[model samples]
Target: MPVTDVITDPENLTLTIHADFAAPVERVWAAYSDPRQLERFWGPPGWPATFTAFDHTVGGLAQYRLTGPRGEKSSGRWEFTRIEAPTLFEVLDSFVDDAGQPMEGFPAMRMTLEFSPTAEGTRMVGTSHFDSAEALEQVVAMGVIEGTKMAMSQLDTVLQDLRAYAQGKGTRLELLDDTHVRITRLVEGPRELVWRAHNEPELIRQWMLGPDGWEMTECVAAVAVGDTYRNSWAPVGDTPGQAFGFEGEALIIDAPRRAVTTERMQGTDGPTTLNDLNLYEEDGATLVTVLIEYPDLATRDMILATGMVDGMEASFRRLEAAVLV
Candidate 1:
């Protein structure tokens, strides 16, 4: 367990948490700054957070939602007020709705996170300042202490590993639920190059070809919301496969950071899937995460059974060898 102490003061209207990790301060700070690593332990065991918007600069805002075991979601936002790199950062945290507006009846709190070097490793100290004693009591009554303990307990695994998680794993798949699946891959390239490889027609054609014997016949780039993108692939020469294609409309586009789209097979009226792609860079590599939401369990299973991961792995390898190189 990472948490060493928890103190609640009704008089001061503060709740403080102290956690120790057996890792360097920089490593621990990376676990918090990187959204992918943050997602691994930002919520309790049953609820996992998905950060849709994260800006780590002063005056920036982050929006995230925690999804329960039964698909229930609670949204929240953080407005960053102070940032001092790997040592200290502070934010105004508040509960928000799906539209990112603060919800009524829930009080906002100022949260300060501080990290310091320790004899053993790193010490993480967090304090939440509430407006009134009643406001502090309200969150405590909502089981915030217990939930935070459970959430921070999972961070040990994230910090202990030297090899960054999923760095060598070509393409990883995690079934989030019956209709939701997440795919992650560490691309050996910078974020801007990876983002461009997915958007530019020429770059996409060079790496997105699934296998050795296929070629991208058509590629239509989508750069804005509501814009449509279509891609087709055909087996070249005597390669044994029929031509197929996919088409989608961009729903949200955030340049080199994230994109959300609705995708479906070409020439078919079947149900569409929501694909959310996020990119985060550290050191010199970028982590690409795609969360796909299918229509039902049957569709999810059918798609996975189609050797999609293997194809994605092949494409990722080609991306490094051909485009990123």
Candidate 2:
């Protein structure tokens, strides 16, 4: 295997490392807080890691189950000791058995991370202290220092993602329902095919609709921050529900992931009523969560009374067919 990211000093118990990355202090700080961002970047060159939990608070702990080079799954934990945002953090680190029971032979160590703000980005320093020189030697031999270095590099990639988000280049959650009903469906084809169907305007009309014969006549979408859009749904083959063409604001348009929000119609003729829209991916499938915080229990009752899930499911099935093609 290639050497771990650590530079070794063959005789000491104090292992120190200083590396500089090109990123801002705030962005670097965000990488520490966001676990999805962490998993995207932190691991060895070939050994990708998956995080189980990461709550970055002064007393919180971060845990990970990493698949090692030889396909062995190794677990580690970091208990945060101190945190001073955008500046420094310290934690107690340890390796453990499969169930997080402290291993009989594993040693606990203190790991401190210090951050220095710089023009290019931030300079990071890591210090690890073992209980004894022999314990330290065993850690080095077992590749702890290398793992630390690899983790740091992964951290760097995380900082880059934070920068992208700050620059408005990302898939961001606009709003989430305090209470929501998620509609999940397996598209007939690949996930990408399903996703594409949801995004195409032409296909959106096939599935998305109003009550009786209410058709989508016109629509325009702005898929990004600070972008507003509208859609017009007109009554067609008139049957039961015909609430004059609904149209409102695209308050949040995170199109990178095909999410949007519309300020739904009010009363039966007023301006808006509903709140937001969110889309998420799951294990080989996708979810659509519509967050509609009502003005009162009455409005909540109003939306739920409309059999919206039924309409939405119908739309989704059409979307499935369109995209699968």
Candidate 3:
């Protein structure tokens, strides 16, 4: 699990939370931008939230209710004051009555959410400024800290499903054969943009590496039927001149649509694998499907045992973030 840190400053009357996700900044931002996704994880465990009104632009208003296990309910309203897509937003949040009016004698907080790129993925920093120390303490006594942590912890699964649904897969994995594994997902970008991210060496270097602290030191892409490409990566603290990577040949190339490659792993005496990559536009987004064929069932099973699926998922999530830029 990624580290989640919460800090409260009595002098400043602020509560700040710092959390990391193995996803791109844009995807993380979607949790707030998309009301349906927001409602899915906005409240703590056992207190599911429902959004009655949501407007994402500046000066918009959002109203929601959280129902407790014992049939009790709490309502809140957020008045948005700032809008910055995939990066930052600011809102004034306050308790609301059943009729959607602000409740008197309750605390209101000015909240700011900031997303930034990090070596591993995206780091979200959220700060809530209360009018007084008493207000901050009031919220803390209401389990705001623990509730927020529980809500944020649910993001990993949300992101996984989001990526899959965006690609039209809906959390399903397709297996073609004993020696082949196919991954199909919706990339939230244009077909050309998604293709460029996959075919261009620089763009590939930006997101293809599995996680943070790893750099693709060398990247070369020749997008032709008979052309070849090579990519190499090194960990941040590794000694200079020590790197591991792969080189592959482009067996088939159909620009911005489909391509096939024969890949060989570096520093290993393993059988070469064939990769078939296809991209298409569907319902205003790009659908990307990748088929990886190993030499045999044993080889495929061995690779799967190394936890490559998780690494691929992380890489694809980063790719989703990259093309949005």
Candidate 4:
């Protein structure tokens, strides 16, 4: 199966982030304690941020920008409720403008981040709590559910790099899933190289379809099936992009190996896809292949008519260079 990004069951509203930084508690604390330093690595990979006030003392608050609501665009903030330095930091985060006006009825969601010293470095956990069931459901419908995943996805990378910097050596994160989907490399490349390419922007954009007068602008995955897949892609001018890109949860994901899964979205209807990736090694050569299975006979026909095969080919070529080199 493929990797997914969010919890869509309405019942599964708690968003969590549990990770370890391969650095001492002091080092990890330093990264978060300094507002100047914290902004350097907040939110997801592409979304840069700016902080207003950051006091890492007890009962201090931290405010920053991640984005605006309604694409009102630019700047988001978090108002702190509790702060305990190297140990914990809590706040209410939302898509508020610089003026601190929150989005409609969405209240300031409370989040708590905890830091504990580990044998190697620091162990961290991020958890958010909504004020009410109604508010939680409302935000989920408003796309914040997936938006949060994108934010987390970006943070995962930042911490990973920070760990490498602290340890002076790279560490690997292996996520493999079990499902009918298959993953493989049609082109020859080492597994390590291909993995890195998946994280590269230039390479991702090459086959991301943003240029076909369309794009896969926002790809947020929750890492499991029945979670959430939110894609927000818009046309540069008047290209009239196809609906809201792609959305849905991952059926399965097999990391450091092959994976298979499908993603669905708003306009895609019952748009379900079954993907498969197969990986094999021969004399240090890695071969990977990605196959997708559409739901129902009608969807299969629809995909073929949309030149999906060509799109897949283009995507693989881009992946080859992005990952292989």
TM, every model: 0.66, 0.48, 0.51, 0.42
C-alpha local distance difference test of each model: 0.87, 0.58, 0.78, 0.54
Q: Residues 14-105, candidate 1, lDDT per residue (tens digit)?
A: 99999999898999989988887888789875566889999999999988998654346788899999999899999999999889999999
Candidate 1: count of backbone clashes, pairs at least 3 residues apart or interchain: 0
Reference-based lDDT, residue 63, model 3: 96
Please state the error at residue 297 of candidate 2 in Å: 68
Candidate 2 is scored at a TM of 0.48
Q: At residue 243, what lDDT does model 3 achieve?
A: 60
Go through the candidates in order and give the clash count of each.
Answer: 0, 4, 4, 43
lDDT value, residue 204 of candidate 4: 51
Q: What is the C-alpha RMSD of each candidate to the true structure, in Å?
A: 6.7, 18.0, 17.5, 14.3
Q: Which tens-of-lDDT digit does each residue in 1-325 have in candidate 3?
A: 3437899999999999999988899888987788867765787544557799998879899999986533468999999999888899999999999999999888999999999999878999999999888999999998898888877765665666544445444323555568867666677788888888888887998788876667888898968878888888887875443467888788766677667788888766667887777675655676676768788999888877866667677777888776566
Predicted candidate 4 versus true structure: per-residue lDDT over 137-238, tens digit per residue:
776676664444544433333344332322322112222222112233334566655544443445455455523566666755545445565656666678
Candidate 2, residue 134: CA error in Å? 1.2
Which of 1 and 2 is ahead in lDDT? 1
Off by over 4 Å in 2: 1-12, 154-156, 161-325
TM match of model 4 to true structure: 0.42
TM-score-best of 2 and 4? 2
